[model samples]
Target chain A: MTQPIRVLLAKVGLDGHDRGVKVVARTLRDAGMDVIYSGLHRTPEEVVTAAIQEDVDVLGVSLLSGVQLTVFPKIFQLLASKGADDMIVVAGGVMPDEDVVEIKRMGVREVLLQDTPPDEIVQTLTRLVAERGER
Target chain B: MSRYVPSSELVERAARGEVPAIGRLISRAEAGMPEARGALATIYRRAGRAHVIGLTGVPGSGKSTLVAALTARLRTQGLKVGIVAVDPSSPYSGGAILGDRIRMSDLVNDPGVYIRSMATRGAMGGLARATLDAVDILDLGGFDTIIIETVGVGQDEVEIAKASHTTVVVSAPGLGDEIQAIKAGMLEIADIHVVSKCDRSDANRTLVDIKQMLTLGAATSAKPEWQTPVVGVSSYTGEGFDALTRAIDRHRDVAFGTASGSRRQLAIARFRLEKTAENLLIERFAKAAVTRAPALAERLRRRDADPYSLANELLAASFERGSAHERDHHRPPHFAEDHW
Candidate 1:
């Protein structure tokens, strides 16, 4: 039997706004993927540690606290240090277009904007994991 | 990601408490990959040194919060703790939202604590098929205490009793009538009972109700060696946790020290053996049925055969094919080869 795609949805930094992340979590679950939510205000280190421990197919970081530029890079560094850089990383929540480009440059495979529909979020995550050939 | 790593190397790293290695081994076990069988066998052999505790309760009973509090308490004693938290999978999507870690976020940064969240993935009895394997992995990783937290379960999910050395059942105030515990069959399996949300005034009713039920049970049953204690704890104020821990420690002593302890061990072994065999049989049957089921369904639709006879025919054919495949491979069944 094929294993379901496992995703870790983390709210890194001091982001107390979790409504968006919760919606995305439900969206992913409805689309047949296991979503592990690492509640609000997690540091980059804590998030990466959980993702590694979970051995999830994807690590999706949700930030509404405007720390994406600083947080995503540290997460990638931690993942690399732990020999888990092969795992796909994705970012969601509010961000400027230019910041999204920079975040993608930092090795985040996908940048899901606030306007990205629920269907697209699911499809994008599914396609990303499929491309990684991990599931 | 599929690149092969020698199980021996992974086992060595895991034995030394390497976090990433432990995580990888757990993933392999959860996926039921054949390559992980050898590593799991090694893990199982190294396990049993750690105390296994199972916590079960209905939804919203503060189980996850209690686990966090309990882990912190155990850590204060310098004990290394490992937690396996199970969450239910959605029946429609076969997906799950494993939010147990939300309550456990504080414990993540501590090196002495390791928490893994599991999706039940359609397994009944309030646990994932690989839950015990993950527990063994943690035990092999040199943890002092391993806690298995089941999904907020309802009646008849007493499988936790067979898997844990000590089973703690949590009941909260205002969920329903006080007799919900007896109705859920939790009274029989609980080694220690906990009334969470004790800060609430109505919590007294639940506590009183459970105490009354225990009294009734004790009167009817013969004198027992170990008495189950009811603990009222408020995860918010941290009240009653010390008492809870004391009860757990005392029970562990009884479980490992007394003659009844040996009997409990035998029961645990029997349960594991039966569960492993059942899982293997279902898996092999599914594989064998894939090719034959379509034709059988067609026959049934055409009224050429009755359902009972066709089912028997399918079972016989599947078993025959299973044995033939075993002979051709010149190996024992996968479950026996891997687990035993």
Candidate 2:
């Protein structure tokens, strides 16, 4: 039997705008993924720790506080240190196109802009996890 | 990803309290991987040590908060705790967002405490079967106590009764009808009834109502049972936790002192055995039924055969095969095909 894809959604940094992440979490859950929402006001360390402990297939960080430059890099580094770098990392929330490219360059797997539809986010996550192969 | 580890090695690592190994083993159990059976067989005897506690209540009754507080209190005694927070899966998607541990962020960093959130995944029981499996793994991993928390509603939440030695029913101020729901059936199964949010004015009323119901239940009951204690606690104000813990300890003492604790153990053993056999029989029957369902359906649609008789026949055939597999060496060839 195949396990359902497990995804962790966290609000990293001081950005309290969690409505978007919560909606995405609900959408992904409705798409047949076991989602673990880490809740709001989570630091990079806390998010990475939870992602590793939960052993999720994907770690999604939704940050609107313009701290992705610092938070995403630290998260990626921590994942590598914790031997979970193989897990897919996706970022969402308000972002400039250049920042999205930069974050992706910093090892963030996918960046869904604020304008992306919830269904699209779900589809993208499904496709990314599928591409990463199975357990 | 740790599936490559042999079952024996996984069990060995889990016995050492390796968190990653335990997580991997539980994932295998949840996925129903073939290796899980072998792993469980190796670890099952190492279980039965952990105190299994079941917490259930209506939504927003602060069951999660109470669980966190109780866990923290237990940890202060230098005991390792494991929590299985069972949440509901979406009926449409068969998926869930397990957010119960969000209230216990402080315990996240505690190595001695392990919290795992479980989605019911359409399990008929409020507590998922996988939750029990995980609890076994945690027990084998040497946790001193394990807590299984579920959002209790309607009749299904009674399933929690089988998962723990002591079942704590959490109710709080407000939700008068929900409290009534608890009184309808849960009051009977509860070892300890907790009225959380004790700081609220309605707390006293809720306490009085629960005590009244418990007293009423005791009066009408036929069997001798442990008297259920109702404890009022406010996790927010950190009040009544000491009393709550003392009540839990007293209940444990009474249960262990009498035959009720052993009865709970027997019930759990019977439940696990029956559940496994039930799963196996259902799988075999469904596979056999598929080949004959179309004709059965046609007969039913045409009113040539009533559903009750057809269902009985299906059940009879399944049971006959189930019994024959244990007793007889030579089996008939294609039993369903030959008969149908």
- Write down the C-alpha DockQ for each prediction: 0.64, 0.47
**Alpha-carbon shift of residue B151 in model 1 (angstroms):** 0.8
Tens-digit per-residue lDDT, A1-135, candidate 1: 677888999998777999999999999998889899998888988998899888888999988778888898888889888878688999999988899989999999999988999999999988987777632
- When summed lDDT is taken over every stretch of 10 residues in candidate 2 chain B, the lowest stretch is B326-335
Q: Which residue pairs in model 2 clash with each other?
A: none
Model 2 agreement with the true structure over B138-183: per-residue lDDT tens digits? 9988898899998555645687877688889888798776668667
lDDT (10s digit) by residue, model 2, range A1-135: 346788889997779899988889888888888999998888787777777666678899998989889898898887777656677899989988899999999988889988898888988988897777645
**In model 2, which regions exceed 4 Å deviation?**
B1-3, B219-225, B254-258, B285-295, B312-340
Candidate 1 — what's its lDDT?
Answer: 0.87
**What is the CAPRI rating of model 1's predicted complex?**
medium
DockQ winner among the candidates?
1
